[model samples]
Target: MIHDIAMIPMIQTQADETQKRKWLQKALNYEIIGTYLQTELGHGTFIRGLETTAIYDPSTQEFIINSPTFSSMKWWPGCMGRSANCCILMAQLYSQGKKYGLHAFIVQLRRFDNHELLPGVTTGDIGPKLGVNSNDNGFCRFDNMRIPRENLLSKYSKIDPDGTYHPPISDKMVYAGMVLSRVNTVVWAAGHLSSGCTIAIRYSCVRRQTELLPGGEEPQIIDYQSQQLKLFPQLAAAYAFIFAAQNIHRRYDQIQSEVMVGDISSLQELHGLSAGMKAFSSLATNLGLEVLRLSCGGHGYSQASGFPRIYGGATALVTVEGEYSVLMLQTARYLVKCVAQAASGNILPHSIAYLTTEPESNCSAKSENDILDLEILVNAYRHRAHRLVNEAAEQLKACLLSGKPQHVSWNENHMVLIKAADAHCHYYTVMNFVQYLQSTEMSKPLRDVLTRLCQLYALYGIDNNAGDLLQDGYMSGEQISMVTNQVAALLVAIRPNAVALVDAFDIPDEMLGSILGRYDGNVYENLYKWAKESPLNQTEVHHSYDTYLKPLLHQSHMEAKL
Candidate 1:
């Protein structure tokens, strides 16, 4: 999967017959492991600002690599600590006294025979993290590291033996890998959310609560409207995300195919869409996992439940690939550009064409069936998102026209603009879900369940943005209540299928690695056995504890008598 989703377009250039026979084949055969190391302690998001330098020395016919400061040290590259023997390192390239932006260098960090660090290389493990601990993320410093002229991954940019430089066909091509990585992260988020929802939903079904009637047995927590409200919407979101994942993946694959054929027209759109979707999807999945965790009550807090680890792992994604807020701004910048282009009477791409249209104030819905229609709710969200984006753009334009600088205007209205971008992305996801369900390829039974989930997701989203829905007359106050009620009812209808639904995801026990979430329904027994394995339980007491407690008790008794 990682190889198939290589982010750096340069990697593709290097993957030709000769290079593949030499490097790629070895890596595929497990004779070598390589880390794509781009992030540094000082620079992560802003690749343009990286400090590591790679100078082309024509006399020696080598590239001299140096990490100029502690902050310039390579950080956060998976498998860099111990597993990787080579790495694709990003460094600022210098040749003939001129500086080129960040470029990739294939550097040998360890010997193939002994696996010892090479001279001029300082490296160590970054230690344990919140999750992804199995990946040996590492830190390294390069001091005057030298490699042959061919070491520079020159498919994109290169220096000849004479120290003359050649530019990449396109500057953005260098960053294509990172953008693809971001898109892959979006699909990964869907899988993580599905895993969490599956566990929570299955547990909810088996765990029963208070009896609903005098002679009735205690009902499954899934039967309660409140419980349904909490878990079912998340289940719905899980399905929605799965569908969105497929859409984004298809879009990414199409973009890759087009780029390979030298079509650069859609690069900017794909970059922005990938960034926005990754940010949106990861945040939603993170939040959804938390909801699933809380729905499980105190058990969710236990490590045995697996929610803690899953939640931690999922939440870190918001920061790792890119910080959520920062990535949202990337999307916002693209959105502003699209809005400007649309204002100039140009046709926008399909991904953002909604931004060009005027929003309607009223949407018609009368009966429960009408309100429950997923298309109707999705359309309502689309209109609301359009309205928000238009308003945000106007606010930004007004500030700019009043003589405020672009950065200043952006800073002043950053929150509103980001929120608008987020709304737009959410609407896209919901529409993707609706369209996916409408496809003939989908099974009828699966479609019915997914349709309910779509409605639940839309209603939950709308309730959160009730003010916009009301102000735009997308829904009346009473209609809002009716939708909310129907959403609640749908959750109840979905309860019986919760266990079966999650079961279909098929996460293995080894991968899940939780006692409470075990498949056999022996949570308490496993919990007890796990507790007994703790080191503290090996011995009943230490001599110090016994002596101190007995003395303290005797002293207390004598003092009381006195």
Candidate 2:
């Protein structure tokens, strides 16, 4: 919790030098266990709507924290149940009968010596989830909990002993934690999806299926066109996300340095980029992992295959940090603003300069062979994204022109907005992939392999969303068919190197935890050996057979005889 969530907000956003020293010293020394508490039973993404309150008591120089309603009870915070003794909590601040917006405060939750719950604090584990159960995610509540006035994280917003208040430099700056979390999630998703693809691809190469020549040897499944279609795109996505993740993380560090100097001009753009990448990466990784799992056929269902565990952990990533749809909408809002600015001749950020330039009107790909060019594929993506963003913006304008309220217009057209965001993110990822291919210095053989992967990635993206490309007039129906053919060709070209590609990831067999994905490819023998390790097989399962099954069988036989 200290390194993952609380450390940044606590030290960078609010804590003064003295406060930082004290907290850092304790945190470093393990004198205090810490967690970040923001999401409540009722509020997940809406931080301003949190019902927990922190009211100032100038007379005693303290802040009284309270969970006024059950919904205000903090839920889903890791380590709050039994590990963390302190939390950086978000609560509504009130002073001198005037309400202040949400603020952060340091609240001690458990006693240090005996690990007992502090008075007025209530917490416990939330119970089993889809996965990650070992982390001990917990729920929490507070009733009239009092802490010294200094406990309020005051680097950004502060209250004096005499009850005067100082506001933050920017209201948006307060959400630094969310931005950091989202950026980190993009990197995490890339690595996770890479691992999952590694396991599934290696297993596929070893797991043979289908004797096309009757009574002949069954071919390895990795040789099938359908299997290549399923797994190769995922392989491409892992590489694409890795490239994008590196750039996003680099930009995040730059933003942090800029923020330290009190320059927040780039904060909004950074937030939008991180939100979109997080949404895109999480959604893609979740879908891609599941596809990889199913590509292995029936064996993928077994826990011993390692797919279930990878999929379970990836599923939660979609909902946490930010809900997928909500974050997509956030990116859509930014795109809408960008479109409006561009129409008025305003300059756009370097990442979005394509919006200012006219979209490619002439068809770049005249035939199936022409469609294989990287520049042609990128142009199609840019044009489609341009049209989608403009269309969404126009929908909003029409709604506002018809006298609908702003919020109502946005809600009614949310579907259009989110689709625009999806297209924009796809365009960004494709461009990043293209740029990396052209600029990166690498061996000729590695470059050749990556070039095919990038082509597959781009063409597959087009094939999957052909309707968007067609509807925007960026590609003809015939052109899309060509894209599909190219995808197939690229898949076949990538088949021989599939095992080698996965091998390059170099994941340890112990870390993979899959009998099917063992390095030596002795799948059938390992499956048997691994099955014997199950607890159910420890004593030949005789206890259950004698205790219930035999008795039931005897009773049934007697009734049959009668």
Candidate 3:
């Protein structure tokens, strides 16, 4: 992940051509391992607030990097603990006695041949976490570490021999590289959510429990409506997120091409798009995995079921890239800008154009038949999102009008802003899901099943947000009950196809790492075999039994005899 997702992108986006030919080649050839080092103990999302300093020396033609305070030490960079020998580091720039803010630099962290930490650097792993123990997340502090000025990633920023700084052509391009990572995160996060969905769904189809009929053979748990309620919506979310991921990936490419040609107009739009995509996809998909895991009953709680590992990785997505709530606020800040632009009579970007025309006070799709119509479902999402965005906007305005400080007002209204951001992301997801289905042509069989999946996804979203949908008399209670019934019916309709649906994900068993989710439907036999392989089973009795259990039992017996 550090190599492909973070390292490669940094070099490709910011490294000079010569630096690229050297470092990029080494990265591609697997000759050098590296990770991104940016977030410090004191600051993460606020880049300008980072405390690490890099002061230039004109005589030596090098920069002295230091973590001046304990809180300034770099933290949470994956692979830096053990595997990585180098990193693209972010540090504050000082030259000609002027502070130039944050800039990226390529720093060799360890001696290449000996793999020993370089002079003036201290680094190591941060031990155990909730999940993803396999990854070596690490921390490092610099003690006036010196590097040649040439090591500066100068594609967008540069330094002159006399300790002068040259800024990027456009300020917006400074943030362009982050957009790529956020989009990649969207895809990576969705992949995990789907993995969990695939595991849970396949396991549900294979595992059998309670008998639904008197004296009849036990039935597969997939037949249970309650199980479907848990599994299908998550299954639907996996699909919705997949479509949303693809949409954002393609959109990133287009805006990236524009950035390459020096047109930075679309950069902010891309930033907001990628930020919200990463935030929402990671946050929602992680929750979806948890729901899917619980749906599997006792097995999901066991490490052997694979939720342990999958969820461990999924859980990190919310905090990395950017913390979910922080990114949502970033997204909401941009949305507020766009709303202001719309009110000024400017044309809005395609993604957010709906905000240009105010949402109707009441929903037109409250009826059962109209509710399921894909366009109406799309509009319903739009209405909820539009209202929430305006609500957040107006609330912020009210706070500002009440004479509070900007920072205080923002903090006071963050929850409302976060809700708006969430609603907007959900709207974008449903819109993308519907648009992808309509635009892409497929076999009728494939189309029919996807359409059903899409319907379930939309209705499930509406059902989940019934209160929001019903606000201002948009959707009535009777109609929401109908939505509940329809959700159940969709789950039943999706049951026969659940196995086939997850099968389409085409995840190999090796990647799944779960006996219960094996494709061959031999869960029980494999689970037994797996249990036998436990190290505790290697001995007839555990050593603790003799050292601890036997002594206690013997003591109890002597007392009883006395």
Best by lDDT: 3
> Which of the two candidates, 1 or 2, achieves a greater TM-score against the reference?
2
- After superposition, which runs of candidate 3 have C-alpha atoms over 4 Å from their true positions? 1-4, 44-50, 68-77
User: What lDDT does candidate 1 reach at residue 210?
Assistant: 83
Deviation of model 2 at 181, angstroms:
0.6
Candidate ranking (lDDT, best to worst) = 3, 2, 1
* TM per prediction: 0.92, 0.94, 0.96
lDDT of 1 by residue, 1-562 (tens): 2332341334654333455556666666667667766545557444443477888899999999887444322333344566777877777889999988888777888999999989988777777777767667777778899988887765556678999998877887777667867877887788889888877776776688788898899987877787777777877877777778778878878887887777878888988888888899899899888888888888888887888778877877787657889898888888888888998989987879987777666767887778887768877988988888888889999999999998899999989888988988999888888888777477788778877778888888988888888886677998888887887778777876787777777888888877756777777788899889887788888566677998898899999999
Maximum-TM-score candidate: 3
Clashing residue pairs found in predicted model 1: 7-177, 8-177
lDDT of 1 at 470: 89
RMSD of each: 2.9, 2.3, 2.0
Per-residue lDDT of model 3, residues 1-562, tens digit only: 5453577788988888988988998988778888777646567444443477789999999999987333322333354567788888887889988988788888898999999999998877777888877777777778889999988898888999998888987766656667787887888887898899889988988888888788988998888888888888888888888888898888888887887787777777888888888999898888888898899888888888999999988888888768999899999998888888988999987899898997666656555666667887888889998989988999999999999999999999999999998888989999999999899989998888888798899898888899998877877888788777778778878888888999899999999988779889788898889889999899998999999999999999999999
Residue clash pairs of candidate 2: 14-155
Backbone clash count, each prediction separately: 2, 1, 0
> What ranges in model 1 sit over 4 Å off?
1-10, 13-17, 44-50, 72-79, 213-216, 540-562
